[model samples]
Target: MIKWVAAFLGYFIFRFPGAVLGFIVGSLFDNMGGSNGGGRNVFQDLTRQSVSPADFELNLLSLCSIVIKADGQVSQRELDYVRQYFLSTYGKEKANAIFRTFNDVIKKREVSAQRICSYLVQRTRYEVRLQLLHFLFGIAQADGQVSKAEVIKLRELAGYLRVGQHDFESIMAMFIKSADNAYKILEIEKTVSDDEVKKAYRTMAKKYHPDRVVTENEAIKKGAEEKFKEVQKAYEIIQKERGIS
Candidate 1:
């Protein structure tokens, strides 16, 4: 799709060589994750030259560091949350090793949310990306309250990661309490009709279904389960408010 379009535009301007070059560039975009087969399961292409396990761990740590430092004062609770989360996911030895590398190297560098998340946005599945945001929000809220600066940084990271605003808000509402948190969690407005509320509940239930994320990592699946439960709880709250069965 993109390849052919670029080739046509190139030929319209510079003819043969330009067409060749354009096709090459477009192929790269297509291979990286373009409109073609947009519905394809991301896990199906695990063997592709995507980010390795080590790089994934390191990049995750970098993002955590960014969030921890966002408020201009590092909280030990946030750090412990990250460390314990990693320990539970990767076991004690591996988690300690990762933290060592993160402190010694990844933390010292000026991490670019755009650069790191751009790579992940292309390679990781949408569900995986949502889980990433959920995890980051967990870090921000670890100290009992999420700071204004931390929310700003998390929102920036979500934008770079190409997560939709509604999805980001939905995940955020889970951690941050608000009067209309239920509606936000369900990704709907309060003015919607009763039928629309039910419809939205169904949609969100499927979207945040734990089984939707097919990964070997139980921690990732557990994160999805948390989202699933949040969605369910939101629907239940809406049901009670509206007197729906």
Candidate 2:
């Protein structure tokens, strides 16, 4: 559509009357499309102002593939995480289109790490990119462990995003640790007596109570909720195992 419009405008721009007619026709076309103008001139102006949706979608898929392949082997769990994330963020149809683009890139083996990193740096804002890194880290840890390959890839991505090493390590540590595992997260042992389990849960619950953290900072509330949930899950697992519940 843009190409044809540009060609028509180019051919019609030579004569005074033709130029005037072309300008009016181009304005009409732009208004119809809700664009500032029609043809190459309009496109150049738009390009200078913002990133294109196609570029955003391509970058998103490339980042997903990079994180999924980080574990040396991509497991069903990881793939499911990606699929679920896409479904949540985008509708199923759009997610499928994005997935197809990702597969195409993999099949061709034509995409380079440098190219992807460059595009991400140029196109994404800092907070968004950081959140994306956290999402990747969460996906990597979803199966109860993080592989060395996954950690390396995460660091590589951190480098690309220009996230400081200290900040990356801090966030990575939070995810890699089994926040979902009650016993591990609370530092309780499987062999701990029923009373000990209850005591640990009480202690950890007090520390992670969402209200307490929410007062400190809104962001800390999320961490607090995760920790509190872990405490509950751990207590339940232990109680069930010991036949207390």
Q: Pick the candidate with the highest lDDT.
A: 1
Q: Clashing residue pairs, candidate 2?
A: none
Please give the CA lDDT of all the candidate structures: 0.82, 0.62
lDDT of 2 at 56: 62
Q: Count of backbone clashes for each model? A: 0, 0
Residue pairs with clashing backbones, model 1: none
lDDT tens string, model 1, 1-245? Answer: 88899998888899999899889988988886643332222222232345566667767788988998899877889889988987776679877987887676434747888998987887777767877889899999999999899999999999998899999999999999899999999999999999999999899999888777755666767777899999999999999999998
In model 2, state the lDDT of residue 79: 70
| Model 1 clash number | 0
| Residues 131-195 of candidate 2: C-alpha lDDT, one tens digit per residue | 46766787788777878888998898889878766447545655665543556645556677888
Q: Which has the greatest TM-score? A: 1
